[model samples]
Target chain A: QTVSPKPSRLGLCAACHGETGVAVMPGAPNLAGQRLDYLRAALKHYRDGSRDVPVMRAAIGPLSDAELDAVARWYSVQIPAAAKL
Target chain B: QTVSPKPSRLGLCAACHGETGVAVMPGAPNLAGQRLDYLRAALKHYRDGSRDVPVMRAAIGPLSDAELDAVARWYSVQIPAAAKL
Candidate 1:
């Protein structure tokens, strides 16, 4: 059996969330170094409509489950700038 | 004239946001080391109903301008664990 590769569109997330998940927009939340469980759950919530932020809903709505997990895992491991201190 | 002190109720923010703003719960976005402008704007949006997250609205709705600014400033300056790297 073959496994799928992670998505390469994470730059979409970086548009507002910053290249490192620190957020470039005023309202976007920082995602770098956050708990993997929370990041995944939040993405699922946005996708499922349980958490209804318009931008987030639209952004993650089209992603597959595996893609969501991959995105979450990507942000979870990013080294937050604050951690460097 | 005497000036009022910054609110001492930041512990309330820490309940879900973590004492250090890294978030202790799933779905709670980490706040540590985030941009000060973004943090303040997010809190204000929550308070003003523009960013309609129910829990965040309730959490920050009652704070005064100074209190809100204080909270945002506090979280802004916190050293995020990821930054230590």
Candidate 2:
């Protein structure tokens, strides 16, 4: 049997979150090189309503555990932003 | 004469976008290493209604040019994410 690449749970996130995860929209935060723990916790907050953005809450609430893990892992390993302008 | 440190136009972005521009929230893209032009255009789109998100439109529409420039400049210079996890 062949293995297929896991689909990104990012959904419409690419509209603002670029293919590499850099934010494409204003007010959207960068996600390239953030710490893993922080990323995970923030997602949990969104899902649990600790953070209250309608878009984020709806988007995060439906994600499965595996999808959440994939998002965290993908970002944790992303290329850090270049230090130079 | 004195100059004040330019405040980040990122506003509440710090809640999800870390101080360094790395994303602290899942599904949010990394903004640390993105191209300058892409960043600026996206903001414009948000403001011009090309991108239709209540959070983004509201945020981008209220910003002044200087504030927009500051945000672009800040992300343009953010440290890229590290290669290793």
Candidate 3:
């Protein structure tokens, strides 16, 4: 039996990171066009507390490995602000 | 009396944030071409502990207002990765 796909976590990311992964908040980083490996590693760092960002730690803590991968993949493909209008 | 200008703190920043302000580490954000106001605000937040990033807090804590502004100015003017080939 096939499992239903989980909902995209982009909205949660967008709350601080903006629709295109360009940050809406001052401290949040633009995730757009970042390397997929970097994104995945960052998420894992937050999840494991290796990176000390309170907001990111909270946001990434509950996500599964698949969810983290999915989020990283989504942001990696977006056009970075330098390329956008 | 004329005081000598302080050296650019870009070296400290470049330790994790590359020579051009793009991140060298997996979790560090690319600071190139970020908004000047936003960069200043982020530095202030880190200095004040309003943003809970240990490395940033340590890095920003000892800096004076002028130093923070200088660092912010330095990063805000660099070209972002999206603009580079």
Best by TM-score: 1
What is residue B24's positional error in candidate 1, in angstroms?
3.2
DockQ for the candidates, in order: 0.30, 0.15, 0.14
After superposing candidate 3, which stretches have Cα over 4 Å from the reference?
Answer: A1-7, A25-27, A35-38, A41-62, A82-85, B1-7, B25-27, B35-38, B41-62, B82-84
Which digits, one per residue and each the tens of the lDDT, describe model 2 over residues A1-85?
2222434776555466654566777656555555677678777767776555578777767788788878766655555543232
Error of 3 at A46 (Å): 4.9
Winner of 1 and 3 under lDDT: 1
What is the Å distance of residue A6 in model 1 from its true position? 6.4
Per-model TM against the reference? 0.72, 0.50, 0.61
Models sorted by TM-score, best on top: 1, 3, 2
Error of 1 at B75 (Å): 0.4
Worst 10 residues of 1 chain A by lDDT: A1-10
lDDT of candidate 3 over A1-85, digit per residue (tens): 1222433876778898776667888766776666677688768767776656788888876778887787777776665654334
TM-score computed on alpha carbons, candidate 1: 0.72
Docking class for model 2 is: incorrect
Error of 2 at B49 (Å): 30
Better of 1 and 2 by DockQ: 1
Q: After superposition, how far is residue A1 of candidate 3 from its true place, in Å?
A: 34
- The model with the greatest lDDT is 1
Q: In angstroms, give how far residue B6 of model 2 lies from its true place.
A: 12
True-vs-predicted CA distance for residue A65, candidate 1, Å: 1.9
